[model samples]
Target: MERDIIEELGSLALATRLKNLSERLAKDVSQIYKESELDFEPRWFTLVYALKEGEELAVTELSSMLKQTHPAINQVANVLVANKLVNERKDEADQRKRLLRLSTKGEKLVSHMSDLWGQIKKANDELLDESGGILLESLDKVEEALDNKSMYERIRSFQA
Candidate 1:
């Protein structure tokens, strides 16, 4: 077997490695959705989940709750609206603010997809268990560490 350079690079290639893994996982999930005849993207899960819980929420609120950027939230929201799975409107009291909620179609799809989501969860748990079971915890620690001090900051400090 050929030695994988990315794996060998370890933390030096953390971003690449993680991205590769993420893309692979996304492809698999997309395949699952395709097989099930669902018109959904793996990226849409977070926004959908947030809207599901919050019912009707402002774009800023969804951004904060999802820990994603306003632009990111807006991009997904637009896609959802275009797909007819979500409804978008201006806040009546604040015309400048955009509001979002699942369309009836979205609600129906959610109910239909609940079981498939459970299966995906179970599969992910098993995969995590197989991979030493601490990846998520380690990722959380890494995220918090980066939040306290970004990679750019840490890198620049080396020259001091």
Candidate 2:
């Protein structure tokens, strides 16, 4: 058996470990989506869901809503538009600002995935419960702490 460097490094490798775990989990769900012939990327789920709920949003608005970068959201939006999963239009009030809305295909895809999404949520809830339900609480606390003192600032201070 191989030694786990992340486990050995503990807090020193927290970010790397977290990223690895996130990727692993995402890949698992992506596999499921692919197996079901969803023709969607796992990364698109949040954006799709946001559009489904809000009906439409500008790229900047989506970036804020998803806590992601404008460029990142725009990139995904481009792909979504190309795939016909989303429609892009100039904002009526602001011609310079583009907005995104789900296409008919996107809606039908979402409707089809609703049941699978529920199952995924249930599995996540069960996993959290099995782990004493601290995962989400701990994540919330971490986010709050990070908001109070950003990781970038912390690293900069340490470097200085």
Candidate 3:
């Protein structure tokens, strides 16, 4: 097997390692979406699912829900809009604000994919079990730690 420079870097390369893992999983998920004849990107899953319950929401709301930046939410929401899966409307009380709602197409897609979603969850659970079933819990702790004390803050404190 080839040597892994990122692995050799250990804790210093944690971000890269996680990113690589994410990309690999995304590739497989993207393939699944394609095979299903769905024109959705793996990245769009969260946003689409968020809108599946028939509530009008803003990009800001989606960002908060996904723990992502507003720009990221805007980018994904724009793609969903362009795909005709979501509709945008002026917020009734706030003229300058736009709210998003799932179109009939999006609702139908969500309904159609319900079974596939379950299978995907089962596959993901199996993958988690293969990895000892604690990765997600550990990730939650790491994210909480970061929220309480950011890496930059920790580095600065160490230098001080």
Q: Compared to the true structure, candidate 3 yields what TM-score?
A: 0.94
* Candidate 1, run of 10 with poorest lDDT: 46-55
Tens-place lDDT per residue, model 3, 39-115, is 77889889889998999998778888899999888898888899999999887888877689999999999898888
Q: What is the C-alpha RMSD of each candidate to the true structure, in Å?
A: 1.5, 1.5, 1.3
Candidate 2 per-residue C-alpha lDDT over 24-50 given as tens digits, one digit per residue, 9 for 90 to 100: 889999999989998988889889999
Q: What is the lDDT of residue 98 in candidate 2?
A: 84
Best by lDDT: 1
Q: In model 1, where do residues sit more than 4 Å from their true spots?
A: 1-3
Least lDDT summed over 10 consecutive residues: which range in candidate 3? 89-98
TM-score of 2: 0.93
Assess the local accuracy of residue 133 in candidate 1 as a C-alpha lDDT between 0 and 100: 100
Better of 2 and 3 by lDDT: 2
Q: What is the C-alpha lDDT of each candidate?
A: 0.93, 0.91, 0.90
**Tens-digit lDDT string for candidate 1 (38-120):** 98999999899887753899999989898899999999999999999899999989998999999999988888889999999
